[model samples]
Target: MAKIENGRKSVDTRSIRTISSSHIDDESSLGSDSEINGFTSDRQTDKYGFIGGAQQYSEESAQDVPTEVLRQREVKWLDMLSHWDKWMVKRHNKVRLRCQKGIPPALRGRAWLYLSGGKVKREQNQGKFQELDSQAGDPKWLDVIEKDLHRQFPFHEMFVSRGGHGQQDLFRVLKAYTLYRPEEGYCQAQAPIAAVLLMHMPAEDAFWGLVQICEKYLPGYYSPGLEAIQLDGEILFALLRRVSPIAYRHLEKHKIDPILYMTEWFMCAFSRTLPWASVLRVWDMFLCDGVKIIFRVGLVLLKSMLGTREKLKACQGLYETMELLRAIDARYMQEGFLVREILELPVTAREVEREHHSQVKRWKKIRGELNFKSPPRMHGARFIMLAEPPRRQDLQQNPTIVVEASQPTPQLKKSKEEKSKKKKSVKKKQPIEEIPNPYPLLSDPPPPPKEPPAPPPVSSEMPQIPQQTLIDSPQQEHPPPTDLSLAKESPLQQSTQSLSSTEQDTYL
Candidate 1:
């Protein structure tokens, strides 16, 4: 065995050395020479088709645990995996408790597949990833994804070098997704998420897990529009008022907006914000639970960051407040205490759902009232129009437009040259199929911008803030991203045409 740098060490490369005269007997404990040499890599994987990374077992953190204890935990988890369905059905609470405690590293890959319904999704969508992988992705998104690949966990062992296995797998998974779901295209946030998944499982499995995340756990989240994020930002604001008034008031007073901090937390699932260990623990629970874990984790971060009125009052501006939140001490987010606090939070999933619906309705009404010349933009997704969730049959039949940006008002006065160019372009127009207007509200153009309303009064005593009046300006209503959202498509649904901002300090 030899020592490695950065507190990471390597396993003994000489473990596989053998002699020709060596003989095996029934009395011997070793099953075979290959088994003694760790099953020659092939059999190293368990029954679940997951090849446990050798690096995971040699980490300094693993060294801290007693060997016997680690082995026993792995054995227990292996037994659970053996009877996964029975255990889940008969002891759902126990399963959740185990997940909250954290899945054993040896078993995390298979456990994630099972917990996120990745296994089932993979089975149902057999060969979908391969098919998607074969196709070239939308070049517009491929360039963006390529730039972000090296940026995602650059220091981690898997992604440390350029064109490494981790980066390659991440590229394949993200590229496959862009082809699979042309509507959503590529979002920068999806890079870190896919990178994390690749560390736990193969690229194919990672792709399915990402899909489950997009469709099941957090619908409308990663798409160009980021509609879910905008709605959820309001939900967070409303929830914050109830959970920690002092913190909320401090933010309002300082003009610190939810979009400033919440986008990274929601988009990356806190992968970049929290320490690696804490991020893994959050992922363990997040896969088991759903997006609510994100909300719970976010509340804990806020409380820890601004736990006291004094701390909240001490903050002076958006930059200072965002920095305070981003630099939360790692000790505060330790899995043990953070999970317990999250469990004790006053908010519930049901409450979150209620708030989401209320906020959405409020957003629709605001759009109708303001009729702003420009539609609201959050991340990539545009606020084209509001519509009820279409029925499943309708979605399958019509492939409804889930997101679309309102066309900017055309310039009325054009130069003679521009007119001539427009006429020539019309003459060469290709036959583009027009998608029928999906919603009545979007059919009519917005009215002229109305007079801006008076700013809402801020009060800790008030539980529900008027959604439209929460921010001083529409720009504040949807905070700008540190990175630009993908802007290659005209509108995104199941499939559609292509159609073509932000200030940020301390975005993770």
Candidate 2:
């Protein structure tokens, strides 16, 4: 191969070969072979592009980002910062020099495509997507997504109606996304984010936007092979500590895991909690800001709930705890105040992002050094029904049915052999010793059952309501599940109870 001084590709045609088979030198056979070769010339031949040429074109196109447009962008950015001081303005200007300015909401789709530096990512992703699309429209998709369809945005109106377009698109995007990423497959919160996108944009554009989120924003949140979300959760909580010290301290005090509240936030891009108006507004920043706002918004929500969290400590019951989250609305009364406060926080979006990245680096450093061992007893799906043995009969006479205390797993065969050996060893010895490696570690105790307080010793003095009014009293306190409580009462009923954040974090 000879080098080209001008950096042009030097194609060596000597390596190119044409097929000419058949030992026949007969005139008719030669003519037929020639005819076949002539037909081959009409078919398309693969052409290769020069890497050097591509680079040259890229540089030239990058350089041609019109000077006038760039100047206007600078002006627009400067105009938005008119309220800021000189120092902040200069810092903003410096950052904008490298990063592109955020696109207006009207042009979000095109802008997101360009900003993500994925001009051809769509075409490539779509090709992979088309291969998966052939397997779509399965009945299982509706059943699977339906189970989680309401679960994702329990508080939202758009996904309230399962057969609604809002939810229908949400399901399609999730199903398509799952089909595309079979390794990660379907996760819990993606449908909510898709619903959020469908609220403002068409389904296809929203689908592409979801593709960008899965690829760029929330990198490994859904992958079974990757535990990045669990790892990043630590970093997010740390940011919460800095941003909302009181809430962080409360979580520390109570053992409330951030995963209880913020898991949905990180997984769904705040679609689970934030109001639609605020969610759409935050999404504008989220696309440009990546997942930084998720952390910030978490801090903001925690701060907003400061008053409510304190009130929560006074509440003595499970119903009361759920009532707090179910009734809490971050936008107007609950989160809106915190959002306003967060916008005024001393940290810049860039600084917060830098801190988030630094924290991630720290997490990676620790993950390498530390052994994150999961508890042995933790398993999925299978739940035990604790039934007590009948005590009426004597131990010898009892129709005793012993429940197999140990659940079978893939590792059960080896465990069974070990158990048999232990039995033999015990039988051979006069003195029996406690077995050390008996089974997977004892399971965590289940939450205590909620038993209605023994009906207060019937007070004959208390007047019972007439049958008609009797029905109305409980109805007033807790409405039919159909009439969703959008105001103050609604969220409380829908909320799930969690351990105090403080305890959860310390243990986590």
Candidate 3:
């Protein structure tokens, strides 16, 4: 009968739950008081209650430039925030460019919250997240969520240790998601992305921000099958071929798969792949621009690593190619320069639309042929291309058409099985020795044929005691099959002679 105030309305939190007797974990008592205070040590407590990270602000660590320049940018951002509604409508281009430059860490959280519509969503879905947090999550997804918490940002100060404030908050956020969107459940990628979000905002704000991201920015991405990620990889490859043909050719020649490098880049929204500074900058643009930022960032990294002829020549094999791509020069990945390159790239919304349509069709066709609803077995593993020629058609007129290779007919499989049976029957009649023995030195008999289940009286474990039965009950075990003609050909004639009888009866 607890009264909960949500926006203008007062509602009982207990009314949302089915069971009255269910025990709800006290959300407030999950973390230690010191760790709780530590999480908001960076931000002004009077201004932001419990929604920010423990990011310390020294004069030196404030910005990447002089205080004066940082102050000017901060002023512009403040003005923008003041007139956020009007500026978002009228000066979107200006807002986008400013975001590309990088949001100051002091104002970054608010900017991301505003850009991602977290604030509005929070107000609209008031107390919904708190209700979700109170419910116990599915054990299936909770275990997976627990496993991925430490794996999210192992080096980040907040998430560095297990059972810390950061880890506890991360667990609550992800667990709430599994309860909120039960169909989507908990995805491995969502953990790192949610951890990044929690670094900027409180659990409630982060939950809403994550909702906007999973639904608006990355729809159909973190579902059970992960169809969006696979389709995007195909689209990215197509864009790569158009944007940097030479680099594309080098990758194709080396068999460097898109899956190898692109999985974490797209799945975690580049949180795991890029440098910290660049990662924050990218996150800013990613929140504003949607998934295109992801494709552009991916293209930039690939083009930088493989774009140069000298770089391509230096990579001798798959391992070298992976190493070069994995280890991008930090100097080159500076936020200012990298964002500029990404913005300048020729990738467009219309082009992505075209590619998406084509790739989706291709995906459906392949799925139909292979009957593969889930991601491929080794979709995350890197594979070397063993010298396949790169296709160089202009994407404008002749987009790559992915025709699904027809599967082998059932008749063909049946014919093959019939042929194998005939071979075995022929081998069985060729009098054991006259036939060329595949294993001449080995005397083990062929394995028994698989048959339908028999009566329950026959024991399944009797096969292991074959030799003991032969010695113990020699007279009773079919009288050694009066085969005088075949007995002289082999030393183990009795055992070999009884092989057929043993297989025919289930008791044997």
lDDT per prediction? 0.63, 0.46, 0.65
Worst 10 residues of 3 by lDDT: 377-386
Compare the candidates by lDDT and give the number of the best one. Answer: 3
TM-score of 2: 0.45
Best by TM-score: 3
Q: Write the per-residue lDDT of candidate 2 for residues 84-109, one digit (tens) a residue.
A: 22322245434333233333343444
What TM-score do all the candidates reach, one by one? 0.60, 0.45, 0.61
Clashing pairs in 1: 224-380, 224-381, 225-381, 489-498, 489-499, 490-498, 490-499
Q: Model 1 scores what on Cα lDDT? A: 0.63
**Candidate 2 total steric clashes:** 16
lDDT of 1 by residue, 424-443 (tens): 89867744444432222222
Of the candidates numbered 1 and 3, which has the greater lDDT value?
3
Instruction: Please give, for residues 388-419, the per-residue lDDT of candidate 3 as tens digits.
Output: 11122200111137788899899999999999
After superposition, candidate 1 runs with Cα above 4 Å error: 1-66, 368-508
What is the model-wide C-alpha lDDT for candidate 2?
0.46
